[model samples]
Target: MLDRGTTSDDDDPPLQKWLARRGKMSALSLAELESCKNYTFQLGRGPQRCSDVPSGLTNSATLLKAEKNSPTKEGLLASAFFASPGDGKGKVRFLTFLHQLGDKKAVVKWDTAVTRGMLYIQLPEDPLHECSRDSLVELLDVAEEFSSRAIVFFSKKRNDMKQLVRTFKFIGFDILPPSCDWIPTSQEYFFMSYEFG
Candidate 1:
């Protein structure tokens, strides 16, 4: 766990800035951290499968399938998988978080091919609030380790877009242009990215 003591500096890391923005005086602690490539389907079809399973973002079909079957909403398990190119050649990475009681907390998907990682999904139950600031900072640190940039897409239908955008900006993510060739563009979603040194 990283320490968040009450200290001020001219060069505080983004995590410190975010923690200060949250206005919490108490130190934040993270739950146990875990990482793996294997994920057992919540529906329990069989043994744990590697993150390289077919249900990845390799193609439109697999991307849709992965979205349709995503377990992020259930909060049952923190699972992640990498989407490689169709030729089955690409780097893969994943991260998972477990609570002190051993319950799953969050899952983050990372893609190294583009040198940009996406926060594919997080726990629907606001794991960030439940787990506190350290967890989010830890995720960012992992993302920085994996790629030069990190991105997340937000649905236009969300009513809290203003607040969400503000919070993201406060933590160092920049709102990207409305159009992006890498993703299926629509009027429904906006993108944001955080650059790492």
Candidate 2:
């Protein structure tokens, strides 16, 4: 019935207990974003080298750049960049575009929410004062193209767990449980997640 911490279902192999336990286990640390202003332009993209950035989401950039040739910094559609603050509530710069990931079809919209844990995504309100419908559709299409299977998380305030769950559900993404942890740091933490296909 059980293996280690995992339980076996009638149709599935013996459940790996550790997997079951850790499956929903979340770790939170107060991470302040480092700035991208200093990032170098590689083939027209900022911070061209993934190794230069911190671990975690930076690795995803490798795939991002590979899929779309370097876009002008000013021309970048959507992105989440590190904030300059070293501690206490860092900021992330998220830019939106017509068709961000280079896909020519399908429109995708952007939404933001926060989880109780430290992980977080930063999403500001619409920046463009007057964008053309074609421009907006193009941005949405690009979002759909780049975010084939990716998920994003945001935090507006601290310890709003219920808000997090509601946001997750609103976005139609699956929620794993009990993985949230609060680790204090010099700066405030933000919850973030991205699912890659």
lDDT of each: 0.37, 0.27
- Where in model 1 is the C-alpha error above 4 Å? 1-83, 87-133
Candidate that would win on TM-score:
1
- Model 1 TM-score? 0.43
Clashes of 2: 28
- TM-score for each predicted model, relative to the true structure: 0.43, 0.25
List per-candidate RMSD values in Å. Answer: 16.6, 16.0
Tens-digit lDDT string for candidate 2 (1-197): 11111211221111122112222222211121111111110111224336576533211111111111223432112322322234333322233222223343443333321111112222323332232233333332333322322233333343554655565455554543324322122122334333323
Off by over 4 Å in 2: 1-94, 97-121, 125-141, 148-151, 156-161, 174-187, 192-197
